[model samples]
Target: MADAREPVVVIGLGRFGTALALELAERGHEVLAVDRSDARVQALSGQLTQVVAADSTDIDALRQLGVQDFYRAVVAIGSELEPSILTTSLLVELEIEDIWAKAVSDHHGRILRRIGAHHVVFPEHEMGERVAHLLSGQLLDYMPIDTDFALAKIRPPHSAVGVPLAESRLRSRHGVTAVAVKREDGSFTYAGQDTVLSHDDTILIVGREADIERLVTRS
Candidate 1:
């Protein structure tokens, strides 16, 4: 397993890159933020482990910054497609084990993947879809695990509130599995066949996105 404190290099100082860098730092990871603009580098100088004003596409600059030593890197140059692809390609060439790139469109994402980006993300598109899902249902939280699978948090439905998992027939009726439950006392526990849910409890269910949506709509 990768060390939890492994340093991460974030190229670009766009909104996505800045947010990712800050969040990583908040989670106790050492983040090296790089950007071409001096102002952008200075803005995060006090927050991240290190901040540099240098072009990521420059192999020499990257090597000088010790980016080759970092196991993970993120190319977040949105709106600047060429730089993003070039940065990702350089990381791949440097044998960075994990390379995540932000792509503005399908074509951009395809190129990033083809050039060896381990992960390609469309943050705007994903956030929009997530908000749409939350707006259309009573789901308290919705997290997509993959193309079809998702984990949903919701208040227990009337039919499930007073029954144990074995008797609730949730899987049989809704095609969803109750993975965990959060009691009224604000504690969470794994849900089992013998676990009974209270009306005020919250449940985390896992299933196909369609199935979870169906269950969410019912509640």
Candidate 2:
């Protein structure tokens, strides 16, 4: 077992996995990049701390490489359900403290969580929503608070500009609340009932997704 201080083990050398490993290694982490393909491992060998071509589903292979000693493990094989799940299970059995898995679908995400993955990310679905928000014109950024609620940074609609939160009745009429005002000058102000909105300012709003869509549509 190599010294395991501040180490991260990354399984799968696909685009997402390779990029993650590179970034972690760049941030001064001891990254062990694992993949079943020798070509994939060789491609990244010069960039990361270590690269190994080994099947992660094999528990003995993982044990030999001291996979359990790493503080975090990332299973980035989204499409390969079998290898991904098996690798996650092996990591769990080895008692890796933190496991982050990339999941292809909602069902896949649930299974990852059920098998002791600390977090599961749905990349394609999340990217689609983000792109939609960017194309919508009014919303600058969108972050999901829950299945039904979101936090949005948006440009104030023409109808909303020069209006105070009290008159806008955003909370009552739209079921949205202004959290903060980010001015064009790159300063932020805490929002209050009396805070007036401006066309140039970006406002952070928290509300149900439907209410947020309504606010944007009103623009």
Candidate 3:
């Protein structure tokens, strides 16, 4: 659990916002949850540090709740573009340290960014991408290390089996570096020229997206 000093304000009382607030509270952050519905506020009152029934789009109401100085504020209003935009704009005007807003589409994300949201999250799209990757056999896992680089776990090709790292020329041909390898016997091997690929071995590779895809599809 995290320390309680970190403070967060969550706008909206929908499932997504409520879940985020609850998770932050569980991690020991002081969370202030706000919504326009009294029933929604009542439902989550005991689970958070503060739960208020007020329109987040109202700047005066937000100021009254001390939201101007929050460590971070999240706009989790789903499907409602008007409230989401208003809330994001209010957070920026308040000069909160960080602002995270959820967008249902790429167009919405662009609008949120234009309004000074520090981060725009597409939860539904990202979740779909992860599920699609999991269903694809070649990729065991995929994680973006940076804008242009990725770290991936992949099964070795049949031709790579029994070949030493130096002779495979994976780095030269595929532009990827094997960081670690899990052998068939369950022993792990860090990157070394002497290491030989074994059948059923899972290798961790770091490289650009296209190169990683080429390595995964290589025969």
Give one digit per residue, the lDDT tens place, for model 3 in 1-219: 323467888898788898899998888788889999999999887788699999888999999999987878899996899999989998999988788999999899999999999898887876676567667778989876665688888887665669888888888988988889997778666968878887778888899988987777774
lDDT values for all models: 0.90, 0.88, 0.85
**Which regions of candidate 1 are displaced past 4 Å?**
none
Deviation in angstroms for 210 in model 2?
A: 1.7
**TM-scores for candidates 1 onward, in order:** 0.94, 0.84, 0.80
Query: In model 3, where do residues sit more than 4 Å from their true spots?
Result: 1-5, 144-149, 159-167, 180-197
Task: Please tell me which predicted candidate would have the highest TM-score against the true structure.
Answer: 1
Two-way TM-score contest, 2 vs 3, winner? 2
Estimate the TM-score for candidate 3: 0.80
- As for candidate 3, its clashing pairs are none
Which window of ten consecutive residues has the lowest lDDT sum in model 2? 1-10
Note the residue pairs that clash in candidate 1. Answer: none
Worst 10 residues of 1 by lDDT: 128-137
Instruction: Put down candidate 2 lDDT per residue, 1-219, tens digits, no spaces.
Output: 334447889999999999889888887888889999999988887788689999999999999998988878999999899999999999999999889999999899999999999989877787788778779877889987777899998987676678787888788878888899988888878988888888889999999999999989987
The global Cα lDDT (0 to 1) of model 2 is 0.88
